[model samples]
Target chain A: MGRIEERFTALKKEGRKTFVAYLTAGDPDLETTARLIPALEAAGVDIIEIGVPFSDPTADGPVIQAASQRALKRGATLAKILAMTASLRRTSGIPIVLFGYYNPILSYGPEKFAGEAAASGVDGILVVDLPPEEADELRCYTDPAGLAFITLIAPTTDPVRARKILRRATGFVYYISVTGVTGTAAPRADDVRSDVERLKRMTALPVAVGFGISTPGQAAAIAPLSDGIVVGSALVRLIGEKGTSDDLVPAATSFAGEIRRAIDAACPSQGKK
Target chain B: MIRTQPDRRGHFGIFGGRYAAETLMPALLELETAYRAARRDASFKKEFSFYLHEYAGRETPLYEARRLTETLGGAKIYLKREDMNHTGSHKINNTLGQVLLARRMGKKKVIAETGAGQHGVATATAAALFGMECRIFMGEEDIRRQAHNVFRMKILGAEVTPVDAGTATLKDAMNEAMRDWVSSVRDTFYVIGTTAGPHPYPVMVRDFQSVIGREARRQILKKEGRLPDLLIACVGGGSNALGLFYPFLADPAVAMTGVEAAGKGLDTALHAASITAGRVGVLHGNKTYLLQDEHGQVRDAYAIAAGLDYPGVGPEHAWLHATGRARYVSVTDEEAVEAFVALSRQEGITPALESAHAVAWAMKTAPAMAKDKIAIINLSGRGDKDAETIAESREEKE
Candidate 1:
């Protein structure tokens, strides 16, 4: 099994819900990102998502968008991010997922991206703009390269369409809790709960709910419904607020810990029969 | 050489496809089905043609530029005056068809993205005609540059929403429009201004705008006794050029050229010449040549014309360029400005700065061709909306 699968499986055995933390790869700078990863892991993050910043992050809202711009301004390319991931692998065993848009991978050539990303200790990949219908090219290489090609399902995904998207989905399904872009408005927990319940009945793969789940209270509310909880814009917003200072990591770590504690407290028992 | 229709999956030779968020796939597929059905329905065609003639003003004049032709002292030049249409641009051709499609699909609201406000004005105009609620997304910079058009869209009953993300240009406006569409998928229809974006949009917009080529073909044959030797149009997202080139694709003898906005020069970072200088990448839901950095982040594109200052072109244009069916060239801001002034003085026509890119190319190329050869330029819009910018540019020069 891949790192993403192994981590989730281990978490299931431990009777715990996973807390996935996201940070832009070169947000204030790559070194700062490298520093934040271990802090995030130490703060109880089960899995780590490294956002490869792009010029046009349409799906993202203001917070992540600004973070991406900061990362890009630091000259963060796919190669640089991959190299940074390789460096991060020396001391940390946390499963690293590269989240980004499709153009960068396409520009890097799918085969090259897959090979390099896998070699860099990256465990999974998610391209926001590339839905299942157009994901074949990237998947063809990623699957063979031992990188889990993650899939996303939104509130708008009907049962029939959800089934089709999840048919070959590996790792986990990212259920976008909201209908709009990331970071705009918080999603209703009741709506997300129903959607997660519907998805759980259809597939054996874990479903992680994300997008618009900001505060620890919201994370606690969503934790009972899914295998994992991905918190992105909220953490990125803190980083944007704090900037590239010495205080950045501690604040982010504290926030992650709060969400992690909330998730662990809410879902005390997790291993399924 | 004649096979140009997109495949069932909407791949225009690996360039165009339905690259969208999972939330949008169903809507896109539904739109594809509706558009395909509408295309085959005779009444749909009849009504569409009726609006084109009676409302948007079809068959806009194909005038021979006698003064320009005489000044060039070479090839005879003709202008397919799409600028004469209501709303002052070729944008209405696609907007009218889309609003009609939205109505048929039982949608009550329409949304559009604009660069220079021509498409916004045209979409607002159509929404007003159909009595539907309209919202137009424009880049913050464009909203400021084309302030008059923002007022025009407001006057036409559209909510002009200024998008401030990602360079605040056409690409960001498209991103905002897509986000809005996803938010309200059931009741809203996204009328993409250009022949770009995801599948069905490129094909549908092309079909709607192909009337330009069809009429030009007939008009040229009737007046000149033959097809023009060359066809030229400015390509931002490539709607107007594709419109004027689609019907004539089968004619192996007639050459086609698309002029890109070279703001400073191709050598500099300040140009919108995607095919000329950019690498193959995806943006706005389609794989096309994009002005992107090595990291695949879309770079800032610049041009004197707000309409042409976009980072990517339509996927069909990517296919056409790759296959060598058409040639893509670049003209600098100075050249386009010179053409804008020349057309105003020489032909008593003030062409939009976007259209001036093509006029610039035509003026340069037509003078070198034989006197008997005919060259046609798709004058995609008028310069009335650009009067302020033009005046500002003149003051800057002085």
Candidate 2:
């Protein structure tokens, strides 16, 4: 199994919910991003979604969009992000998913990107704009390279289409908790719970709820409803606010640690029958 | 015979596809189904025709510019007078069609993105006529540049939302509009102004605007006893160009040219010449030639004409360029300005700066061709809104 499937399987067996933390690569610079990876892992982050900044992030809200601009202005490219991943692989075995739009990957040459990304110890990739109908080109390469192609399921997705999307899905399903862009509005726990339950019945793949998830209270409320929760714009917003500080790593770790503790306390999956 | 393109899945030779957020996919699919049904429903066709003819003033003239031909001293030049449309541009053609579709789909709110504000004004006007809520997303830069159109949109009862992101131009406005659609998909209808965006949109907009080509084809045959030797139009997101070019795609003898805005020069980091100085990449939900950096980050496109300041071209234009069916060229801001003034003086017709790019290229090429050969420039919009910008530019030059 790939690292993504293996990680989910191991977590499921342990009766523990996962925490996926996202950070925009090269927000201030790659070195700070490198430092935050281990920091996030230390704070109980299960998977790391390194956002590859694009000039136009239409799917993101103001927080992530501003973070992307900062990263792009700092001269971050897909090549540098991959090199950072390769370097990070030397000391860490954390599952890393490169998250961004498709244009950068298309610019990198899909075949070459798939090969190099796999060689760089990347686990999966979630292209926000590429739906299953248009994913064949990138999947043809990433699938053979053992890289999981993470698919997003929106609230607007009808069940019939969801089933089709799930069938082709390899990695865990990313359930966008809201219909709007990331971090724009909070997802209601009641609304997310039923969707998570419905998704669980459809596929064996783990369902991770993301988008508009911020505070520990929200995380705690959502933790028991899904296999995992992705906190992106929240963490990205924090990093943007504290990136220039001397204690940026500590601040990020503590912030993520609060949400991790909240999830574990709320779910308490360990030792459950 | 019609030249079929965009197939059912909206692929124009692998250039156009539905590359959008998952939240918007269902809406796109819903739109496609509704559009397919509307295409077949005779009532929908009749209503669309009624609005085009009675409301938006269809059948704009195809007038011969004898003075322009004499000044250029070459091929006889004809002007396809899209400027005489009800809203002062060809944008009304697509807006009226989409607004009608929105009403048929039971949508009560309509939103659109505009750079030059022509599309925004068109959408606003249609919404007012239909009694629907209207909102327009315009870039901050464009809003400042095209204050006249912004005021027109406001006067038409549409809320103008300024997008402060990403160079504050048409691309940013489009991004903001898509974001709005994502959240408001249940009730709001996004009226894309150009022949870009995902499936159904490019095809739908092109279909609505193709009336220009159909009328020109018929009128040219009557006036010249044959088809024109060449057709010229400026390409922003390429709606006007495609409108005039789609009906003639199957004609082997007729030639077409799309002019892109080279803001300063192609060598500089500034031009909007996507097909001429761009690489094949995806943007605004369609795969096309885009102005992007080596790292695949989209570069901000610059043009004095706000309408032509987008970094990407329509996907079909990319396909047409790739297949060698149409030629694409670029004209600098200076050349466009010269043509803008020349057309005003020679023909007593003030062309929008966007359309002046086409006039500039025709001036260069038509002079080299035989006098008997004919060329038609799609005067995509009137320049009343651009009078201030032109005056300011002239002042700077002086």
Candidate 3:
């Protein structure tokens, strides 16, 4: 609670919106992803969310789901993902958050996961399907080990649920930008902005907007209202089209710079984007 | 004595094997070795017995059904009352032992699949007792029909995740639960609640449930002076029947009879009479007689008893049937109802509709045997839960 609160205050004082970039660890290739991660942090990503692929990802849309399949087919496992993070930890101290559903986490026992994630320089984890009510034991591992567990709050969540998430969540609260699966929509600028506004009244935890935000304008629009804007499929979609590691690195950085500029102007007093 | 040593490589004579996902192989092997070691150790059995008696409430009474027996007229009928076991049905016997095994193995979470919600309730009970997290996967339809059990599970601190793909019944729920088990075998114990599924589970669950037969053996010997002429019990996955009959297979004087629900009839599309109308194929991790199509789609089979309506019997039962160690028979819905009413009036015992099929078979068969000879039916569950369905179906039958 204290770390997340402190992070929010620091980011607010700096007047820089958080830039979160999510990518499947072994999506294109495990080795390629290892190189891609540090570059992402350098590209202005405040936090890196690396997805550990599973066979069934109920919450993700077709593009990310296909990427997960590709990752898993190349023998993408928890060990491989952990090994990738270990390699990336040499020089990178940027907060790394492992993201996936419960299956992979349960596959890798919780205590072992916390120890390894801490060893590999991972700061947090976000299980997409394990809601706040269900996340207590998972946090038992993370809290004792000093690893952050970022929790998600959906559009469907009522006030009580919002409070429950507020009480239960650690690290940063993931404010899903829309009603449904990831990568299925282009961002709705004002709706996301209002959702973030609604969340601010409830909790002091830093809110990072995720799900449908893609392109420079949407990121720029969301930046003003949020502590961070999480960009996932849009970047993965870019990598898929280019189909090469060489150009994708520079492209990711350029996109981050664009989103960063939006965050610069995205203050409460600055008015609407 | 129980057949403790299965084989060198976990096979029960080419029937059981650890053919699963690559990740699960190590965990399955570990479970096999631990189970073997635990059974051999004396202290483990002593503790299990203590829990079986104190915590789980074993050794349910065997009551004579005077009306049911006289109507059949073949032999005197008695019911080994498993329905009276704490938490209802024989499922708790296996779950308590398995949860203890899970703690011994140092696993902390419990996961299982249930169709009729009985197994789910039992697993949830064990999880609550051990103070371990529990998750049960049930079909979407079952979640609605067994909604009370769903609430019961949640109140007991187990999460009931509704599986909503394919047929969305027992088999599909099993598939979903297995998928979770394969990935998370280290942290969780997969508590299968029957004498079905793959290797070790069928054998393991049967052994836990052997309390049913062990108790019945003692009770029948004391009550009847000699073992009954025929030992009749219902076969769904064959846990209660196997628990009762398998121990007495060596007792040649006690003829073993397994009653399967005739369902609608022997007509392949209607009933759950697997041994009578099914072929040998691999389903639910065991090579056994199954009610499945050529392409391996599990067909919808019906029975008055929700528990006995499953399409596959345990492989060990198939072997027993093949080797002539046991005889298999089927009882229809109307006949089962008559037995239900007869037991309710004669002995004031409301047997589970599934267990009623066995009582029904006993009623029909006992009359033909010499009156001096005794017949015992495994009354696997009490009908307290079925008071509503029994009343309605009793009308539907009339």
Candidate 4:
């Protein structure tokens, strides 16, 4: 099994849901981002999504966009992000997923990127712009390298198309909770719950809900509906606020801990002892 | 001569495809299917043609430019007057066709992104004609510069939203429109203004605007008793150029050229010459030549014309350039302006600044050709919408 599947299996056995934390690599700087990964894990994140900064992130909202600009200002190239991933592999076993747009991977050449990304210990990848139809080339390299190529299903996806996408999806399906770009808008929990249930009936792979879950209460409300919950813009916003603070790690850790507590509390029967 | 159909996966050589969010895939597929069916239906074609001829005023005149031709004293010059079409630009041609298709698909709302407001005004006019709700997303900067067109859009019953991201230009407006389409895909039709974007869009816009080339082909044969020696048009997202060039791709004797907006000299960073000065990159769905930085961020493109201020060209143009099927060149703002004034005085025509780029290239090249040769310029739009900007620019110069 891939690292993502193994991690989900472990979480299932523990009777707890996975919490995926997303942070832009080199937000303030690459060193701080490297430190933040272990800190996020210690605070109870199950998987870490490293965002490779791009110039134009069409799928991103203001907070993550600003973070990307800051990261780019600090010279965060894909090679540098891979190097940082290799450095982090020296200490951490948390599932690492690289998240970003498609242009950089195209510019980097898919074959070279997949090989280098695998050697750097990246467990998976999620490109927001690459739908399943355009993902074959990337998958040819990623599947052989044993890296999970994660797929996304949005609220707008109809059943027939969703089935087509799920047929080729690996690791897990990321269900975008809202119809808009990434931000802190409140998602309709009941709608998300029904959508997750419908998607669960389609695939054996775990389903993770993301995009717009901001507060601890919001995460708690979404915990029982899916196998995993991803919190991105919220954490990126905190990093932006405390960018110069020595307590940046502590601040992020505490926020993640609050989310974990809420998830455990919301699903007491599935709580890890 | 190369056949120009995209592959099943929507690639033209190494350009064009549905490189969009997974959320948009279903809608894009649906659009493709609907377009295929619409194209094959006789009644649909009849209605589209009727609207083109009646509503958008098709068969725009092919006027011989006696005065300008006399001044140049080399080749005979002709103007394919797309500028005479209703709504004052070739933009109305694509907008009317897309809106008619939208209505056929049972969509009640349409959304579009505009750079200089020509496309916005054209889309708004079509929406008003069809009684559909229209919303146009324009960059804050574009709305400010083209304030008169913004008012025209509002007067025509379309809502205009100002985008405030990235460079606050065409790219950002497109980003905002795509975001809206994803959010409201079930009920909204995205009427892209140019021959860019993913599959079906590049094909659809090209087919809709090819009326220009189809008519010009017949008219030139009728007027000159032979084919023109050269064909020229200015390219922003390349709809007008593709419209004028698609039919003649196989005609080897007819040399074709596309002019890019060189805001300043190409040696500087201020031009929008994507084909001449850019590398291959993906933006706004299709893989094409993009003005981007080393880190793959799309850079802001500048030009005297807001319509030409975009960093990427259509995928078909990229394919044509790569395969040497068509020559791509650039003209600076000063040269285009000089051509703009020269055309106004010499031929009693004030062409859009975007079209003037083509006029500038033609002025430079046509004068050097043999006197027996003929060159036709696709006058893509009239200059009424640009009067204020031109006046302000001349004032600044003074």
Regions more than 4 Å wrong, model 3: A1-273, B1-6, B391-398
Find the candidate with the highest lDDT and give its number.
2
Clashing residue pairs in candidate 2 are none
**Model 2 C-alpha lDDT versus the unseen true structure:** 0.93
In model 4 chain B, where is the ten-residue run with the lowest total lDDT?
A: B1-10
Q: How would you encode candidate 1's per-residue C-alpha lDDT over A1-273 as one tens digit per residue?
A: 888888988888888888888888888889899899999999999899999998777788878889998988888889999999999998899999999999988988899999998999999998999988789989999999989888999887889999998898998899999888887888898898889999999999988989888899999999888898999999999998888888999999999999988888888674444
**Candidate 4: true contacts recovered, fraction:** 0.60
Q: What DockQ do you compute for every candidate structure?
A: 0.72, 0.87, 0.02, 0.67
- The residue-by-residue lDDT of candidate 3 on A63-90, one tens digit each, is 6766876776677778778888887878
C-alpha displacement of B193 in model 4, angstroms? 0.5
Per-candidate clash tally = 0, 0, 10, 0
Give a tens-digit lDDT track for model 1, residues B1-398. Answer: 44645888788887989888877888898999999999999999999999999999998999999999999888999999999999999999999999999999999999999999999999999999999999999999998899999999999989999999877988889888988887888789999999899999999999999999999999999999999999999998999999999999989899999999999899989999999999889988888899988767788899889999898999999999999999999999999999999999999999999999999999899989999999999999999888888888889989
Top candidate, metric TM-score: 2
C-alpha positional error of residue A131 in candidate 1 after TM-score superposition, expressed in Å? 1.5
For every model in order, the TM-score on chain A comes to 0.97, 0.98, 0.91, 0.98
TM-score, ranked from best to worst: 2, 1, 4, 3
Task: Determine the backbone clash count of candidate 1.
Answer: 0
Misplaced by over 4 Å in model 4 are: A271-273, B395-398
- Model 3, A40: alpha-carbon shift in Å? 32
Residues B11-129, candidate 4, lDDT per residue (tens digit)? 89888888898778888989999999999999999999999999988899999999998898888999999999998899999999999999999999999999989999999999999
Model 3: per-residue Cα lDDT over B295-330, one tens digit each: 233455577676776778887888788777789999
TM-scores vs. true structure, each candidate? 0.98, 0.99, 0.60, 0.97
Tens-digit lDDT track for model 2 on A34-65? 98999899899999999999998889888999
Instruction: State the TM-score of candidate 3 restricted to chain B.
Output: 0.93
